[model samples]
Target: MKTMRFTPPGYGGRRRDPEQVKRDGWREQGILAVSVDDERLTWPERELVRQLGDRLYGPRAADDGGRHG
Candidate 1:
């Protein structure tokens, strides 16, 4: 036999997309947290972010420092 669990409202424990969260924060509250070129990330990490950004949100502008952000 299996037991059912009760989940509370707004507490479903759903994992959010970090990238979307960052974008939302920037768009809704003008908060630019953890950019692709924040200098804190390594080259590979930056490149991964850049690639994901490009794939998800299209390519970045040419004047945006080669889409490093």
Candidate 2:
């Protein structure tokens, strides 16, 4: 299995690059297409997608240590 890593562009407190954002969006669209065609995800792939979603849209609480001042 191939490994994939997702990093938000310019994630370390820098402005994101528009080209990188477009590339990432394309990658995400590809994943969505595959998921739709396959109709089900393998366990590991499912977990990876879940984690990615969390990174993208998860809740942030004060005690989670991810809150911005």
Colliding pairs, model 1:
none
The alpha-carbon lDDT assigned to residue 20 of candidate 1 equals 87
In the order shown, the candidates' Cα RMSDs to the true structure are 12.5, 16.9
As a whole number from 0 to 100, the lDDT of residue 46 in candidate 2 is 63
* 51 Cα displacement, candidate 2 (Å): 0.2
Question: Candidate 2 overall Cα lDDT vs. reference?
Answer: 0.57
lDDT (CA) per prediction:
0.79, 0.57
Model 1 C-alpha RMSD to native: 12.5
Candidate 1 per-residue C-alpha lDDT over 1-69 given as tens digits, one digit per residue, 9 for 90 to 100: 976588777777877799889889999999766677768799998888888888878877863666654
Regions of candidate 1 where Cα sits further than 4 Å from its true position: 1-33, 63-69
Pairs clashing within candidate 2? none
lDDT of 2 by residue, 1-69 (tens): 976476667555566686566667778775342231233677787667656655876833532567667
Which runs of model 2 end up more than 4 angstroms from their true locations? 1-39, 59-69
How well does model 1 score by local distance difference test?
0.79
Instruction: Please give the distance, in angstroms, between residue 33's alpha carbon in candidate 2 and its true position after superposition.
Output: 7.4
